[model samples]
Target: MSSPVKVYVYDLSKGLAGQVSLQLTGKQIDGVWHTSVVAFGKEIFYGPGICETEPGRSHHGSPLRIVDMGETHMDEQTFVEYLSQIKEHYTADKYHLLDFNCNSFTNDCLGFLTGGSLPPYIKDLPSDFLSTPFGAALRPTIDAMFRGRASTGVLTPPPDISATADSSNPASASSLLQAVAAGATSNNSEMPSSSRNYLPTPAPTSPPTPVQSNSLTTPVHIATNPSSFHNVLHTHRAVVAFFTSATCGPCRMIEPVFEDLAKSKSRANDVAFVKIDLGVGMSNAVGGEYGVRVTPTFILFLDGNKTHEMKGINAPELRTQVDLLLYQAFPPHRHTTLSLPAIEAIPLNAILSSQVPNLDIVLAKVTGFIDAAPSWSGSTTKEATKQILAKNIIPYLKARGSSSPPNTSFEPWKDATISLVTNLSAGELFPVADMWRVALLEPAVCSWSATKFGPGSPILVLLSKAEGAPRNYSLTFLRMISNAFANKIVARELLLSSRSSITALMVAALFHDDATVRLAAANLAFNMTMHLQRLRVEKVRGNVEGDDVGENEEWDIEMTSALLEVIEREKANEEIVHRLTASLALSIRLSPSIEQLASLLEVLQAQKILKDKLERGGCGDTGVVKKEARKLIEEVAEKLCS
Candidate 1:
């Protein structure tokens, strides 16, 4: 059964904003809006992160109005699972009043549940308010008001609200609702301060200007007052504050030690090192607020709360505390605990093929084809395309290949390429595809194509058209797709949005009779493996935006099967074997669930096949490529399979 989803809209200013906004900002704002999604008998909102209460019984009291959104077909269990997946993104430290707030969280939940959004007035208020002069002037004050407070992190959900209740048991849900409503009403008088209304009054005097640093490696000097100190603490997950005075001898003794620690230990945006000089003007206020009575004191704050404090020039103790804070903030991956040197040593940089073919010969072949075709007489598209090649695309590729800045815009070339791919047949498209193979090497072209066309991009379309065509068409198409990996955006789009199509194309190309076509296919595989491995490395290093482990496990499995099949039949080219082996190693190494991949390899009898190939010294003139392939295969066999 579908449940109704409603939006509970509360006026944070409690009718005061509507009365004073016009006079204050010269704009007639309706209200300072805070919205929550009401569904599954709970009022869900984001404040100190994803709080829930009975409908009409939150700390905000009664909402001004309730807007009924459409019903959601998603079951309660499924919705709760979705919430668990997204709860981290809505943490207290990440919330910004104007950027990410209650309304934003409501809109996201509404879209997930009912495929709907909050009302336009509530959604557009921040942008509208910012457009006014007074609103723009108040931005720093607003930022200080919200971000200068200590973060409470993610809140624990109320015990009465059981997210794991059975969907079929209507009585359980009814009991939960009643319990929540009673508990909320009984505690109404004792409720804590609402997140929206917890602002502290700003100081009357203006703050001191901060001494800015050029890079994250340098520690930020505290300026202004206690508010600046709080702002830095609230912004980063882990912070190390150095409290010092200019004339203190011990402060000078440990200054370089602190600088070295900042350079080595600080992570961009995640961890921060701050300096507060008590002898400096206005900065003394921060020292008083933190209650530092002595010089050369080090304090460590995690999630806006003091965790550790140290005094004097004890470098060992300071390092230990800082390392502990990092460990708590970002725990090392389980893979790091394992003994796998080969997997750990894999290079993180992408192996992009940027070699541009001779543009003069490429342009001549394309323009000559256009001139010879009987369909090209007096055609504007043909003339325009020729001009684009000679005047635009050719020169751009030549300049980019030579490492000089290209003066022309990439937009015209993109348009012409799309037109040709749409109009020409597979037989007549090889020359155009060859030209694009060179152009795709340029990052600008790949970014433009990805942004302009997205999933139905010109490169993907061209590859689809050239699928079963002649050897030349296939080779160029493979090279074009491989070169598209030059831009991460395009590569991500192709990997995620067009996974099936790209996978099928790769599998077919691997089985081609032509060695050159198979070689191009191997190159594409190597690039794809490099991209995926880079994501794995980032995730292992605790990058929040890295690709989740096992996200592409299915794709990797499919590609691995095809590669094993091709490798077993390969003869005459050691480069192909080496590239294929490298790709296979990367796919299985450091996999979140290596046992699954090892099982697949064992079922396929891969170990015996690889051993036989190793004994044969591979298929080439020299044993060099074979040696590299053997090393990769053995690494996989021992570390992955064992």
Candidate 2:
């Protein structure tokens, strides 16, 4: 059975915040919200590290509001194990009032449990508070009050709480489970004290197990056998193995340094640091295999082959070699060698529109169109289409705009939309296209549509039909394409497998006689460029999995060609020019092969076209968009073309 999750919202300031917030921050605030996730009969929160209690039994007393956070299909044991893995990241020392606090913890837990997040008003309060002058002035004071109060050891539950079976296994569960059994059994009215303490030692029969891969920050892997030693080297791209013995004083001295390195670097899956004790069972044979004659021997392995070795306890050398090993294992992107400051500063965040249109009016218009059409007269298809729109699509779109709506089955909607678009005339498609334009803003809907339909999705088909249709149909179609960038999955499809068709549509729309259609096309172009740029940034950070570099390069070249073609034709609209230039700048800057792109720019004489645009300003020349465009264009020219 799926467990129902809820967010318990407490007022940290009691009643004082609501009364004084307007005077202090120049804004009327309701309450100082502190949220906690209630799941599996326990109330889990973070403050002085991850803490727990019975629902509504925390020191904050009853919640002012309890937001229903849907349900989690995750099993209890797996969820407990997940918490243990993230416990170190939420330690008491890491907590901050305006930063990593209770709300942040609950937000993360809710997302993990149900793929949802806390409401914007609750999660965004800290930034809203900090944006004010008085709040900014009070930051240091707030920091001083909460700082230096970190618990010295593992956080323990309050005294009234009894340990659960899951709590006994600290290796597999975090302190969040400490009160589950007590909360389940107790009926006391008195709340437990919200104090931080150390957990009592477990029974001797239940010996603490070594930390596993789940907790990479605590990196002490005791390799007792050769297979275990080789396994670490095999799994990780780079391995730093420290051979140590109990008798060596130098080994004891440098062990802490090795651990610190492991804590810093081991979080990435491709690197590992293992400490092999020669004195432990079967560890001596593993040491002998590597020809280790003395204690404090370090060996560096890359791709399961020993590459470098060091003797004695030299912390500086060990640090230097480890850095070199990682540098060699994952080489930096070639773009890092460039001197393009302006391009490097470009924000890669995707431009997504979240505005929800008046759904009632949209539904009325859609149903009205269907009811009035002679094509729908005396047919069950008319009623079925309205039912799907009113019952399934409209409610889903409304709920999805505000919260993580349940994953309602979209197969019916998908089949119905495809069928309608395939059969409907271009003049009759605006209502359906407009509804989809709004629905595509929701990432789940966008992703589902892309996956269900592949290259021949209804949206793409609508775009094809709307090419020469009326302004309303064409504008709505372009807007729908622009909103597809809000979801990465569909955005990637538009950039990759569906690139040729989308490129043709965008190129044709860019030269449209209608300025609004051209502007919409430009906005679509910018959104696609931004998505590709984001992937490039992620690739540089080593966070992106798979081959984003090749895909980005391919899209950059093709998008540059398309943008350059339209730039010469766009004469009057500074808005279209601005978007086109911005998209071009993003595509050209910090590219994997800047030299190749510069060569392309040279071939196309992009410098002259951009310079000519600057010399002969737009028709209504406010010069703001033109000036920003020039700054970005000049940066590109100086860095790439010059």
lDDT of 2 by residue, 1-642 (tens): 899999998665455555444433433456656678899988887654567788887756788899998998989876677666556555555554454556656756775677676675664354345444544554554444334333332222222212222121232122221222122211112237642211111111111111000000123343544655665566679999999876899998998899778745553347767777776545687899999999899999999999999999899999999989988897776556677666666566655555678999888987776777666422338778788888888888878746567557777776667656655677778878877888887655764565543445766667668656777877777788788876665775566556777767777889889898899888888888787777666655644222343354665677787788788677788778777877887776556767677788889988877665665453244433545566766766565555
Q: What lDDT would each prediction earn against the true structure?
A: 0.64, 0.64
Deviating ranges (above 4 Å) for candidate 1 = 1-5, 8-100, 104-346, 374-380, 401-406, 548-550, 617-626
State the lDDT of candidate 1 residue by residue for 1-642, as single tens digits: 999999998765455555444334334565656678889998887655567777887766788899999898989987777666555555555555454566656766776676566675764454445544454554555455444432432222222212332122234333432332232211212344332211122111212111000000123333323544665676689999999876899999997888667745655456777776676434577788778999999999999999988999998888888889999997765446757655555565555555667788878877776776666422248889889889887777777756666677766766676666666667777878877777777655664566544434667668678667887787878888888765565676677667778778877888888888888888888888777777677666644334322266677678778888888877677778778877777776656656567788889877765555565455544432545456766766565545
**What would you estimate as the lDDT of candidate 2?**
0.64
Residue 47 error, candidate 2, Å = 35
Question: Among all windows of ten consecutive residues in candidate 2, which has the lowest summed lDDT?
Answer: 207-216
Model 2 CA RMSD to the hidden true structure, in angstroms: 15.5
Each model's TM-score, in the order given? 0.55, 0.55
